[model samples]
Target: MTADMLIFFIFVLSIFLGFELISKVPSMLHTPLMSGTNAIHGIILLGGMLVLASAEGFIQHVAGFIAVVLGSANVFGGFMVTDRMLQMFKRKK
Candidate 1:
């Protein structure tokens, strides 16, 4: 298989693996997991920006831009979820 096909296959495998791992986590651990994943998303956003900066072709630029946008959304959404989870534990006024 070509390099692009191999990368696509790996991406698909990672999606399945991530889904299985997340599905097995207990609810009690989800908040902590979300925080961790937020950090990961930050890293992904940085990587995407770096890739976009170095991208040459129109397709690569578009793909890199999409990756950066999605990564940024994930990071922000994760933080929002984490904040909401923390709020649930705060004593009511």
Candidate 2:
């Protein structure tokens, strides 16, 4: 198999594994899991930055820019949700 095809297969497998793992998480653990995933999503931002730097054409540039934007949004939203969840557990003075 070609390198690209191998990467694609791994990506598909990871998607399935990710879904299964997430689906099994208890509701009480979901916030912590999301918080962890948010840190992982930070890597997405780095990937986006790499793509943006290596972009060689208009289409590539646009796609890379979009990836950066979406990754940023996902990271931000995840942190916001996680923060809200943690706030619910805080002891009031």
Point to the candidate with the largest TM-score.
2
TM-score list, all predictions? 0.59, 0.61
Candidate 2 lDDT by residue in tens digits, 7-78: 999999999999887777768777677686875676698899899999999999999999999888877777
C-alpha lDDT values of all predictions: 0.84, 0.84
Q: Give me the overall lDDT of model 2.
A: 0.84
Worst 10 residues of 2 by lDDT: 34-43
| Poorest lDDT segment (10 consecutive residues) of candidate 1 | 34-43
Global lDDT for candidate 1? 0.84
Error of 2 at 9 (Å): 19
